[model samples]
Target: MSYPESLERYAALGVDTEQALQTLAKTPISLHCWQGDDVNGFEGSTGDSGGIAATGNYPGRARTPEELRSDMNKAGSLIPGAKRLNLHAIYADAPEIPDRTELTSEHFRPWIEWAKEQQFGLDFNPTCFGHPMAESGFTLSSADSRIRQYWIDHCIACRKIAADIGEELRNPVVTNIWIPDGYKDVPVDRAAPRQRLEESLDTVLAADVSKEWNIDAVESKLFGIGVESYTVGSHEFYLGYAVKNQICLCLDAGHFHPTESIAEKISSALQFVPSLLTHVSRGVRWDSDHVVLLDDPTKAIFEEIVRCDALDRTHIGLDFFDASINRIAAWVIGTRASQKSLLLALLEPTDELRKLEAEGDYTGRLALLEATKSLPWSEVWNEHCRRSGVPLDTDWMKDVRTYEKEVLSGRV
Candidate 1:
């Protein structure tokens, strides 16, 4: 069907395709930088990935900050709509290397300048893992006071730097904190470590960082590589902490149990927390960060957020890292899939569905829901790509292949 035919169908259901396109175009989806290099940041401290692992070598994986940025630039060109760059503290590029604890905005001036040039917003994360301090699989929640203090200082510095970057860019940055603090085996005393974590978090957030520049968020995980038995920062832990502190709560798509729905969690978290940060990732069985597709889980996340009218308060970011495929293609594919899901949700006839449910017309709601699936949403998607000046279909793959031949193949 043509674009007009698709629009007519949506209009019949009280859906405004034009409005959805406009809203989607304005929404900023932050892309994770670590995907380009399989989470190996510029810190150069290798060995023991702190429970985060990106499988497969696939040649041309970015080995330097410059290469990663160039790859991101290539991926960004094919992805439509507003975009933001998410950075880890380990990606710092300063005159001299500084430990995570001592990182400042000066270490990221080059990144900030590049982001400005690209007209993209910036988000940040404190590198809480992959360093010598996190080799024990515990950092903030460690029983040792010294270990906890180091991570606390690192988080504080990251928050300050994030705020500074946001102030410089005039866009508030979401500084999310995720720690690989957990025990592989069942701990005799879980309460002690949790207590330490609570205390350390209070100290780290004690500084008065302006919200106008920085938005603080805490991410939770069910389990990870070495921390399978017990994850220190579980969902309940972060939920309670976020609510108590009135901070944003991060719900990673791949961090929960297989049957669990991040879509449901959005409604629950937004009830208490001021805002939310969603890390849209695809997890296979475990938290295997695979490239995202326009799958059911991805669609549900965006649908729920739109239904709850929470887009303004929700920050959407991609968090998958698949090394088996082309790194730049991974970015483009995951990001574009996310964008398509959001667009699908935006095009939903939410008011009609709600009205049917409110009137106890479950039959109509069910029928309408199923029937809407058959509509020409693909046509609308094609129009979106065309309007954005990107490839309307799989043609983007040709561009990526050309890049691989001309650039990536040359990389040793």
Candidate 2:
């Protein structure tokens, strides 16, 4: 799984060699089923298949254990040849009545058992009960021992469940922790949250050091909503904090401002974190999570893929949630588009490009774009399909065009 020499040279220039190479060697993209309502038979939000509802209640009820198992089996059957499948949790908050809290283990037990039976890895998020604290902007003020203890207990429970599943299946399982604990009005004592977060992470990490579990601190950026902004600076702050304690970073593409360069941001983040995981989605004025073409002519995503390929960092995760198409289809299309973009980037003539970059030849580098302008995207798609051993169909170009149209219309 060694990278090419060109990438090694790029690494010598202070680009993350190992992280980049590891990313290039693998495309462990996982499909998230967070918006299950987009699929048929499930309830949905009004005006959109899975958008936020006026009432906090999303339009769907939880599927029973038997039904969940059946759905997993069906989803598995639909994509039998997929290289891997990662299951996300069903709820963000403790649902009304909390049906089967003790059976939380039982609910996931079938899916875990099924992945083992079918041989695919599983990734999940730790259950943090106090998500409202981020919006309420009072995490620091509460200082309530009970609230603090609740957070501690939730982390322990999440780790215990992850360990139990990992031990049962003997596979690498990821526990992603996306914090919603920042302030909304004034600058709070950053040290307290950082200390609590690190303490909670240390507690989880210490429980089973031998288990193949990773804790990814997912940094999200929000606009016009909070005093403590969720910007790239915040992400950098956490990565530096995590490095002090040996943790991982999950980079979300949609979490950046529309003006930011995702490639440069990713490159900068990689300088600190050894491994990278990102959510792929488009945004307009801010972080909107719109699903756009990975190779959109805007060139933001294309350039990022090129840098990632040149640096050999390819550990990408597809995070797409749109209400129009089938949720499963959105994931499949997004994954395919991302792979197409990466393969095209790999085909780039790096030696010439690097020379132009050194000489401050922005126009010369831009020529690479014109040269690739006539890149028969169909050929790229076909090549990707062939390399990945996936089936190709005539409808792919149509799908790409439809996706492009959605990007233009800002529906995705």
Candidate 3:
């Protein structure tokens, strides 16, 4: 818990420790459900999805909707503050398997019911990869009219399903569209695929879905496993489309070049796009989707958002899958690290820094920024976890280890 001395130290800087804790408590971080099952959805697929693959063969992977939810419950119990579950289209539950194009809200009725019971918000994504239809390495942007139309219909259905789920939960669900469409080698006509993608997106979003229940976002990638030469949905392509269409632009931390940072794009994108959806992920070497750590890159993301006063317009969601370790612990560690970064960002003396920058006092600005790195924000985080009834520090790991022996071990 936060001591009096720590609280007073932060208070002297014109920052409110109580306000930061409360804001962090209210802020909902969307946890990706696929982590529990290594992105192997319930549609009876045998192989790993396109481009993205979760490495390792760790035991106790969730095998059913119930098991996944149970794992999520255990992870959520260890993480303090509000949370929302991010669902992929393939996780849809139904007695009979339905193709991606034929999916509806009924297929996801079980998930909706579970989320209602848990009292958590929900978000959705159209599974644009892994199906036989997408085996050609292109989906919405495929030159073949038949292949492209099938994906377009699937995306349309996903948006409507997202609306119904959001309406049921009374929270607007962010339905993000990310497709693995590109070429491994240099293509003669890169412009044609991007043009087709734009047209397909226009048709998918043509339906009159209310923003009150659903928000549309387009995600971009620099390259994937096979698409190293050229990616159809490049960052520039989606940024232009999102800005022109007035939809949300999703910036993934792992979707860019190694040296690039999504944190620097926050303020720039918000000036044009209506809102931003940030996928908090760690990219080791390339877009490996490693478990997120509270590293400098992740910290800069929250810092920029809070510094720009764009928390209300930005959506935060986790996007990583690691099958190497305890999945539940992966979720708890990544999510708590994100929440801690947000807390540190909130506790910053932003006004003072901005005042210095505005007055051309660059020396003071740098000095204060460096000094903020050594503040007692960790104490404030402990206080938050204490109030929220979650374990503080590594105490939460003991619960995970016990669960592994009792619950997860029996799965095999």
Candidate 4:
């Protein structure tokens, strides 16, 4: 259908197509770099002892930073709208021997420089697992003080690195902390570990990083692989911490109960937290980071955010790494799915729907919502892609296959 024809359909529903398209254009989706390399950064370590792991041996996984960047570039071109790149501390380009604890921003200079070239804002994370110290299945909340101190230093260093990047880029870099601290069986003493965690976090956040450059965020997981009985950084713990510490809460959609709806959690979180950083992912049965889809959950989350008028307040980032498929294709699919959901939300006649609810017209509200399902949203999405100078169809995947043949196949 023509753009004008689609616009008229949406207009009939009291939705402004032009305004929706513009809103979708500027909304930034933070694309994760881990998807290109299956969370294996340059460290060349397989000690991701705890936490969720990307489960696939997909060929053409980018081994070097250069390859990763090229792959990200390919995926970024196909993605519509603004984007920011999220990095883990493991992705650091250390000039010398790898040191997880004594890391600095200098170790990630190459990343900052390249991100600058790409005109992409950078976000960062502290790798609290996947090292000798973290192999004990704990970090900040480790029973051993020395081991706990190591993770603390690492987390503190990450904040500084994030601050430097943000200072140079002149945009706040979100430094998120997600520790895989839990047990396979029931824990005899849960409160003690949580107390230790509270103390360790205090030391980490005590560093006087400028808020202008750094936004501190703590991610809570319901549970990870073996850490089933208890997660030290549960949602309740981080929610309270985020409120008291005045930091951003990083919510991963897949971290909650499968039956739970994270879309419904947006407004509640915004009320307490200063800002929010969300990691959008899809989980099949558990917290398996499958590639995000344009499913009901994904669409509902974006719709809720739009309805809450928290688009600017919430930072949306993709966190799934589906190594089972073409890495670049996975990136494009997941990121595009998110963009499509945002576009759908923006295209909704939210104001009219709200008016319906306010006037106690419940039936009209459901009717208008049901009617929106048939509107030509694809036309607006295609138009957005055309304006962004990206592919409007499956043409982008051809580039990925070409890259796989020319660049990736030769990796071994």
lDDT of each residue in 119-141, candidate 3, tens digit only: 77999999988888888899999
CA lDDT, every model vs. true structure: 0.91, 0.49, 0.93, 0.89
The reply for model 4, stretches above 4 Å from the true place, is 46-48
Stretches off by above 4 angstroms in model 2 are: 1-26, 38-86, 89-107, 117-119, 129-142, 163-170, 187-195, 211-218, 223-233, 295-314, 355-364, 386-412
lDDT of 4: 0.89
TM-scores of all models?
0.98, 0.68, 0.98, 0.97
State the lDDT of candidate 1 residue by residue for 1-412, as single tens digits: 8999999999999999999999999999999999998898887875457788889989998888888888888888898889999999989886687877888999999899999998899999998888888877889998878888899999999999999999999999999999988888888888887888889899988988878999999999999988889988999999999999999999999999988889999998899999999999999998998899999999999999999999999999989998888999999889989988998899889999999999999999999989978888988888988898888667898989999998888888
Candidate 2 per-residue lDDT over residues 143-233, each given as its tens digit: 4545555545555555555556666767555566554455544544656666665555565456654345543444444432343342222
Error of 1 at 290 (Å): 0.8
Superposed Cα deviation of residue 88, candidate 1 (Å): 0.6
Backbone clash pairs for candidate 1 read none
Candidate 4's residue-wise lDDT over 1-412, tens digit each? 9999999988887889899988888888889999999888888666756766787887899888888998988888888888899999989876573678778888888888988888888999998877888888988999999999999999998999899999999988999999999998898998999999999999999988888999899999999888888999999999999999889998898999988878888899999998888899997878888899999999999999999999888889989988788899998999999999999999989989999999999999999899888889999998898899998766777877888899888876
Model 4 weakest 10-residue run by lDDT: 44-53
Of 2 and 3, the candidate ahead on lDDT is: 3
Better of 1 and 4 by TM-score: 1
